[model samples]
Target: MHIHTPACPCFIIPSSMLRKLAIQADGAERQRLLEQLERSAFLRGQRAASGLAAPGLLVAPGVRHRTVYDAHHGTRLPGKLVRTETAAPVTDTAVNEAFDGAGTTYDFYQQILKRNSIDGRGMGIDSSVHYSKRFNNAFWNGRQMVYGDGDGKLFTGFTHALDVIAHELTHGVTQYTVPGGGLVYDGQSGALNESMSDVFGAVVKQWHAKQTVRKADWLIGAGIMTPAVGKALRSMADPGNAKLTWSGDDQPGTMRGYVEGGDVHTNSGIPNHAFYLAAMKLGGHSWDKAAPIWYQALSLLHPDATFADAAQATVKAAELRHGAGSGEAAAVQGAWHEVGVV
Candidate 1:
């Protein structure tokens, strides 16, 4: 069945956060925030106009094909081609970061999960850096990655952070992996979409660092935002902890504090925490078991799958992989129960 899925770019920084920061700021900073927010909205419209992907997708066989473009502080996407898969590092930091980050994310999926590229085929990875002047976000536009250099005060730069890059790219992974073109970007399903990105984003970062679950700092988008704004975007280990994240952090670790109509990024903390709990309980490298189980669960999920559905899917994935009464299955179920999902 061909689902006409609207193209909603998954942004690394949520719009709500930008709005909150804008409200707190004044003069030029506030104006900049508002302008960026406007740009974000405009981009969403532009993506919709560009059209969504039709079902029954086809791509090249699984081979790592990466390319980086320089947006040159303009709005146009897949801008000036600067780097290719075989090219050497360029002088521009953003270009190099985009190139390398995409490569690392691709490697993590291919090597760790034994999956191909984003589409489970050899789909080319394209990234554009320096998109718009002092733009404060990075996003996967259902096709490629686009990043903005931060306003220097609020955000440093998008490409510098590995997890931020991985998070955005994984949105593409989720897009092609999930049935019906991708999870609908709202409510519980949207939260699951965001959580999927966060899960693999954390896993990729951990795998890159060779860090165990205990050694890995369960933070996303670390060092992207200015320290004054926050430590990171969210804390999987202790969601909703403002001190660990930022003053504006309001993610709930479990269902008791679930927002009635929360932004996907906000409610994602529930499943994000569940994944963290599962990984910790499994007690090893996150990529070892927790991540694979989650990866497998993607194929078993529908686009509108809820938190409860995801909980069951992961538990089933565990049982399928390790056995009906295995430690993996028990841990997976326990993790969901702890999060009040099942």
Candidate 2:
């Protein structure tokens, strides 16, 4: 005797039919499926939203004027400008260095890439010096760039280095473009974002200083840090090493060993290494070849792009802007592969 199992007509749902049922389902069983569906849908929404958030609101276009304020070393309580009467007069060294660096960053976008300002609008470039007593870092606080007067033991003043200022300000540029919603600050994507800033920061310095690839120091934050420490904040050429031996390793040497969990600042070394390799291979001023490709990629590509995505975008941009077989394209391809971006 053969026992025939009858198919439950209601349960005989086709794979495609199930989707329709899932959408139309109601009551307890439907609610259960919908909950699962809602969770998945929410996750997707998050990913989509992640791609759209502006890193920071754009201030304006074209580098404008600089306004230096004195934060007075206190985290809270607004401070006044360092007028001669209010505080020690703004030192000539501080004024000139800050002016030149901000100018170069402005010119970099204006002359080369034609970006008006951090947001493609003529945003006034504001820089505040003597931010806090013994503060150790400089940052682009969404509105403007703020520099700290280093602890004097670990850092002098952020304004001391043209590249350091450029680096901080470029963070605003990154904010306006991809924004990354602070999510990209981790993993390979975060590393690439960090490296992009370093790439632009170094290029701004080299372009202004007229340094070729060979002459460029390939170090970020070279002068801001204290002399007692052996190296700069980071080294593009040899990431795992510092300019000064005492500063410890600068970045992760390989992709396999990259620091995970979106540590924006720390994990940036991977892409920094790729930029150095690409610039060196191209054999010229970094701004001349590498900067343009990176800028184009940043502006036109997706915000949540990973290191590999960036590498591929750079390769594509170079090819489209230059030629498929151009030296720039080849360099980008090779550099990404070398850094394990492939």
Candidate 3:
């Protein structure tokens, strides 16, 4: 299938969060965060204008290739090539982390989900680390991965967190898997897009750690942010709980708390919580059943699919993968009900 790639890139950090943090911050830090926010807006415009995928030669299935680059605190993407597959690890922590994280994410999809790569066609993974000075965010810019150093105060760095890397990379997977190019980057559809990444991001992390659903932390972007800022970016287990996540997290886990026009990140908590509920109910390694069911549902979605559409797709996927009236299907249905998606 020819997957239509979307022009817009998906960022791990939401602009709303940046704005909130900026308002609270003072001095140079505030200015830097605001600058990053402006850069993010400019990036959207820049990417929309290009309307092109990451330019590179495609490889066949079963061939794993990952390339890492150093942006050297510049705006240019996929900057100078620093490392490649099979190469020795470099001294730069960000470079090594980017390479290793991509490798692990690639392995998780190939070994567990039976996917070739982000595009399921052995498309080479390209990443750039240290993107601009204290840039404060990471993103999959339609074509390649870009990591920001982040202000040391709030974020230690982006590339070092495995879940963070997987989260950004799964954005690429969603772009290729979903029909109609990709999910629309606004409204409920956009929230679902973010949820998909969060779901697979946590699954990839748990799979790598050999952690079962109960044993898993269920926190996205953990260890990426400083403890003073928050435990993580968001919590799948309990969304909108400031104690579990950060002070500024406004994500709602159920329909009652749903915001009419919330940011994609905020609204994603609904689907994220649903996936967590489904996974916990299944009671096993997430990659075994829950992940596969969700992964299969990707092809069942359209660009503008609603929350109800996704709920139905997941229920159908569980039935198709397991059986009619199977436990998997029931769990998925009940999860959607719990989140009021049905």
Q: Which candidate number maximizes TM-score?
A: 3
* TM-score sort, best first: 3, 1, 2
Stretches of candidate 1 exceeding 4 Å from the true structure: 2-7, 49-51, 54-62
Worst 10 residues of 3 by lDDT: 1-10
Backbone clash count, each prediction separately:
2, 15, 0
lDDT of 3 by residue, 1-342 (tens): 544334467889899999999999999889988998888888877876765475465777667799999989988777899999889999999999999999999999998888989988888999999999987899999888999998889988998889999998998898888876778778999899999999999998998899999999899998888888898999999999888789999999999899999999999999999999999999989999999999999999998888999999999999999999999999999999999988
Q: Ten-residue segment with the worst summed lDDT in candidate 2? A: 5-14
Q: Give one digit per residue, the lDDT tens place, for model 1 in 1-342.
A: 766343477899999999999999999999999999998888777766765543223445446688899989998877999998788999999899888889899899888887778888777888999899999999988788999999989899989889988898888888888877778888999999999999999999999999999999999999998888989999999998988888999999999999999989999999999999999999989999999999999988988889999999999999999999999999999999999988
Task: Quote the positional error of residue 167 for candidate 2 in Å.
Answer: 0.6
lDDT of 3 at 313: 94
Each candidate's TM vs. the true structure? 0.96, 0.75, 0.97
Please state the error at residue 291 of candidate 2 in Å. Answer: 0.7
